[model samples]
Target: MIILPQSIAHVQQLIQPGENYYLVGGAVRDALLNKCNNDLDIICPGGTQKIARRLADQTSGAFYILDKERNTSRVIINESNGDRIVFDFTQLRGGSLEADLRERDFTINAMAVNLTDPVHVIDPLKGGRDLLEKWLRPCSGSSFRDDPLRVIRAIRYSVALDLKMESSTIQELKETVVNLDQISKERKRDEFFKILGRGKTSVSVQLLHSFGILPFLGIENLTNFAKVLQRLRVLDSFMSYLGNDSSLLKRDYFQLASFISGLGKQRKNLSNYLAQPNNSYRTRKDLDHLGAFLWDTSHVDECEVFKKLALSNDESTHLYILLKNRNWLHEFVENGGVLDNRIIFQYFKRLGDAGLDLALLTLADTASVVTAELNHDLWLLELEVCGRLIETWFEHPEVVDPKMLLSGTDLLIEFGLTPGPLIGQLLENLREEQAAGEVLTRQEALDWVEEKKLK
Candidate 1:
């Protein structure tokens, strides 16, 4: 039986009476699995643009032609409740709906249902059966060769949906995995990030490595793959806590019950904290996974293999910062350093909000190696350090990014200093002092600057 989401059913009402439209691809597979998907893919034998344009006009959605040569277009509708619905319209690839389904990437994704007769699933490739069996199979023998990126996508589906790869499909994937180099870097990055965004990133990374895919993505050293996986698994655990999924927590994870209890009240705060986007395209959690994966890789930003991923400057910088300072908090705890306003101020001064990112990275990295009996003391110390940093970031705003006690303009006007680097130096000193509480009021700031000037 084919199931249609209410949004897709509603979209069916917008198409003109006589046009033949088939709801295809992931939308069909998700519907069968009783999953919710706001994005829908529709295909027609001809005149896809006409149908797409009319639908956009009727729904007042923004329209754009995705691929003019293929007659593929898209309509994006913004609902009142802040939910987004995306519809992609394309002409059937081989002039017939059956032929089109046969040309898709995976069996589970190749199924379709005709909108006019939504009850009948048009599965020419037995995709629905594969879905029921929890197996990921190719639509045809050349599925991966036709689009090498599907190799990564197949693994993503497996990890995200808990589907086992069919034996033959796995063999074909191994044979075609090398051709993934022929695919563009941006496309590869998109697929890889999707895997990271999914929950079971450790499993995803392990599969990518076993399938001979990590080398193409610039991961060379398997010596640390075990360590990387451990760190990523720990990172996933933290992510589960941040996402409020306590059930996924393992029994042995009870060892860290004290740390989790400490964060109990700030769960929502931590959730909102990591939910923030690093750029227009990627979130802090996305980088969190990247940081874990590259935990041991040195000079991450300078590596050419990583350069091929074509990450944004902000993303690359964030990853670089996370990896570079992954051990700072650990070392601090090991040294028995105190968590004070001065350190917190300097921490955010160097890392900004990424101080929290570093805190999470350090905790996960530490947790990866913490045995049930070993390093318990160090682990508790690190947790105390991280908890203080996180609490200051969420609860005490002034301690992190304190109000500027003295500005460049203030220095120029007050001390008759010219506009140059000294003014900047003075302002920096004042900010540090103010955040440390050594300089509280404007008069105290002036006196501190005056003392420094006299020196």
Candidate 2:
């Protein structure tokens, strides 16, 4: 018995008499797989815009037209459990539901369940059987040709469901791989992030590479592809390590996306490729930062890449700090694996709120290299040390960057010194001294400033 989610059951109650509505796409597929799915998709013959509006009004949800040409619209209902249920309504393509199913990208998504009779599923292309067989099969030969974006979508579903693609579908994918360039970057970006957002990023990426789709994303050479995939796997492990804490999992999407944004290819070419209007990512600022970090090996032209990508000042500064300080972990290991409090404090102070995020990235990078060399014990030790540093940073943040004990106004008033750039320098010096534990009290800071004045 395939049981529908509560949201789907609620939607079934909204189906009016004589209306030919069917629950379609991922909702049906996931239900058969016994997976939790909040997104509901429905297909109706002729038109869907008017019905979608009425459904939104009845459900007290917000509605928006997703694509005007195709008569696709969506209604978002917020559930009390903090999960969002999205109802996507689309007009039947080719004048009938059967035609619509045939036009879909994959067979698993082509199955539909009639809202009027949920028991009898409408499987025109044997998609239900494919779902049971754990195989991803295209509905037709022209599926990829009709929509080249399906190439990436195929890889996404393969990894998401852990299904093997039918031999024919793989052949179709190879034939249609070249047309991927014709697809809009927005579509590609969304699909790319969707793959990354899933926990098994490394698997999805390897699938894409194996299918010869990496070249379209500017990753032409296969030489460094394995290394990049290893890094992504390391990142996935780090995410799992921190998954016990809900707060960390909440931000995993952006962190994972940023980590793999510039995996393969170095030089301005990849940056140029990403900056193109068609290849623009969802979060352009984050992509630009990651791009700058990956390329610009000398770190001299990050600002140049930022300007080309049209990043904001704050975004540029954050990227700069991350890239500039990414090697701190390497330096620490080189210095006999000693945790120098001063160096750790400086890293936390420079990274500020992004301290933990950058630390994760650095740890993942180091672990990737160490694992490649088969040094499991070293990687475990590094993980423990980095975990402790991150915990201490959150627990005693004041130690990372303490409050100013002396102000510039106090310096001028007591020492009769003229206000100038030297005041800013003195303030920074005092902060460094304070962070280093050399100065702890306001009186000590004042005395230190007086001594500097005498010098």
Instruction: Report each candidate's C-alpha RMSD, comma-separated, in the order given.
Output: 2.4, 8.2
Highest lDDT: give the candidate number.
1
| Clashing pairs in model 1, backbone N/Cα/C closer than 3 A | none
> Which stretches of model 2 miss by more than 4 angstroms?
9-15, 44-62, 244-325, 337-341, 369-381, 404-429, 438-455
How do the residues 229-335 of candidate 1 rate in per-residue lDDT, one tens digit apiece?
88887778778877987644773364357558757767798887787755454678887888778888766556555587888878777778887887788778888
Candidate 2 structure quality by residue, lDDT tens digits, 183-247: 76556656665676355676787888788876665444344656666666666554443332232
438, model 2: CA deviation in Å?
4.1
Q: Return the TM-score for candidate 1, rounded to 2 decimals.
A: 0.92
The whole-model C-alpha lDDT of candidate 2 against the native structure comes to 0.68
Best candidate (score: TM-score):
1
C-alpha lDDT score of every prediction, in listed order: 0.82, 0.68
